[model samples]
Target chain A: MTYCVGLLVNAGMVLLSDTRTNAGLDNIATYRKMFVFEDPGERVITILTAGSLSVTQTTIARLKDAVRGPDVDAETSIMLAPTLLRVAEIIGNTLAAVRADVDEKLVAMGQGVSASMIVAGQRRGGEMRMFLIYPEGNFIEATEDTPFLQIGEHKYGKPILDRVVTPATSLADAQKAVLLSMDSTLRSNLSVGMPLDLAVIERDACRVTLRRRIEAGDPGFRAMSDAWSKALRDGFAQITL
Target chain B: MTYCVGLLVNAGMVLLSDTRTNAGLDNIATYRKMFVFEDPGERVITILTAGSLSVTQTTIARLKDAVRGPDVDAETSIMLAPTLLRVAEIIGNTLAAVRADVDEKLVAMGQGVSASMIVAGQRRGGEMRMFLIYPEGNFIEATEDTPFLQIGEHKYGKPILDRVVTPATSLADAQKAVLLSMDSTLRSNLSVGMPLDLAVIERDACRVTLRRRIEAGDPGFRAMSDAWSKALRDGFAQITL
Candidate 1:
């Protein structure tokens, strides 16, 4: 299991994901789920995945293969695509195909594959966009009315996002919102653990601006988590019955 | 589609439940899920139900018939049960029976019956107790380390309860905690709606000491919800990115 969230605000885009993957309680492992593809001043694409590792990894590998192929074209390569929407379509179709192939082989053994992803970035001359692509290859774009998209262990972290996020939020504030959202999910769910992968892409920059890894026992994250717990207790004490 | 939570603390017990039930998006109705049975000075039992309305309604009806029957005895009637555990057992058995009966009939239409419940109260000579009863007549009791039990769409409201609730929490504080928990669930889920039933049982009283119904336009609830939202936004603004 994993927890990943992506937000598109007026200033830019923020994406965060946990690195824990488990086949069972005793088989837990850490695996990075964020992948980035960028061409300095031309285009930037970030993908955050959650679900069956085999499917997501294979799909991403195939996507990279397409981008590096000798005959790379607009229809087959995400970097060569005309718009972010087309990039999402190519990724979605690839993800669906990979999942179907994996599921077919695993079905005979009473096993299956399941995966979904968040696509966020900008391309020169094109507007910034964010989408949640499903395992079935269809996707929904985040709009001004709903400026965020999340997948996996989402409910525990949703209330805070629902109350605090909006399209006009600043880039810095958007990062804080997603971090807190991930914090809530990490505390409530055992399957989702740290260290976290975080990235920020400034609007229209067509490149990644900030990328950081919050390792276990990182002071900044610890301080924020403690501060949040204290604030919640204080607020709880202040509320009248 | 419902949200019901029950908490047991040193001071007593707090139970809150919403009254919304839905057959589909187009078919929604208001139905009370909390039922109270009290012999005042001798014993008290509160049942909070969630799932198939047919199963729960039939189970409650049968339990009432048993209590009112001429041959009612300790083994057959909740009011005459010696301990809260026995009362929970009686309720659990009844629920499982009712579910099986309902499922047998609904199976012809390719439908099924599913229901679960939280039983909380105390008997005059026994200790306070709370149990979450499953559809198969099995149940798990709440302990001091984890003093809360929830059923139906529970994740959205769980983080707060996990942070604030404890066995030593005061009755007043417990009530506030459960109400806020319910408020979170109501905001995040469409199936859990307005018109809530709240009840508190004092530690050795063996009966409900406080009970109230919060209607849709209730001022107190509205004010509390608004205050909580404001506190969250203010807290978010104060945090550093």
Candidate 2:
């Protein structure tokens, strides 16, 4: 299980994901779920994945291979796509193909493989965009009314996002929103563990402005989580019955 | 769908449930999910139901018939049960039986039936108790470390309860905890809706101390929801990035 969120706010996009994976209670492991591709002033794309590690890892490997391939084109590679939407399509296709290939082998053993991802980035002159790509390859974009997308163990962390996020929210506040959102999930769900990857893309910059890997016991994250918990307790006490 | 919560606090017990029921998106209606059975000065039991309405409604009906039957005994009737645990067993068995009966009829049509319940109460001279009864009739109790049980669309309302509820929490605070919990579910889930039923049982009283049905526009409920939303937004604003 995992928890990843992608936010499309006015100041830019914020992507956060946990690094936990498990076969069951006894086989838990940490794995990075966020991937970044930046051609500086040309284009910048970030992917946050959740679900089967095999499918996501393979899909990512294929994407990287495509980037390194000599025949790279707008139609074949996310890095060369003309629009953020096309990048999502290329990634979605690759994810679906990899999942199908893996499922074919695992299905016979009574096991299965599947995965989903959040694609967020910008192309030099195009609008910044974010998408939640399904395992089947279909995708949905973040709109003004609902400026955030989340996958895996989403419910525990959703109410806060529903209340606080909007397209006009600033990058700093957006970062706080995603971090606090991840904090709620980490507390309620054991499958979503720490050492998180966080990335922030300033609007039209075509590059990630802020990137962070929050390890367990990191002072800044500890202080923020402690403060949020205390604030909730204090706020709860202040409300009249 | 439904959202019902039962809390076992030191002061007594608090049970709260939403009233919305929906067969599908276009087939939504309001129906109470909280059922209270009280023999003043003797025993007081509250049942909060969630899942297939057919199964829950039928189970409640059968339990009522058993209580009113002429040949009622300790094994056949909840009112005559020796302990709160026995009462939970009676309700669970009844629910399981009713579900099986309904499933038998629905199976031919390629449908199924199942339901879950939270049974909370106290018998005179007995300790206050709460149990979450599964569809199979197996049940688990709320202990000192975890003094709350929730059923149906539970995730949205869980974080607050997880943060604030305890066996030593006061009755006043307990009531606030549940109402606020229900408020969170209502905001996030369309299937769990307005007009909530709330009940409180004081320790050793063997009868309900307070019972109220909060309508959609009730001033007190509105105030509480408004206060909670404001508090969350304020807290979000105050947090450092």
- Tens digit of per-residue lDDT, candidate 1, span B80-144: 88777888899999999999998999889998989999999888879999999999989999999
Model 2 CA lDDT for position B19? 93
Interface RMSD of each: 0.9, 1.0
By summed lDDT, the worst window of 10 consecutive residues in model 2 chain B runs over B180-189
lDDT of each: 0.92, 0.91
Chain A TM-scores in order = 0.98, 0.98
Quote each prediction's TM-score: 0.97, 0.97
User: Candidate 1 regions off by >4 Å?
Assistant: none
Q: Which portions of model 2 miss their true places by more than 4 Å?
A: A109-111
Residue B207 of model 2, lDDT score: 92
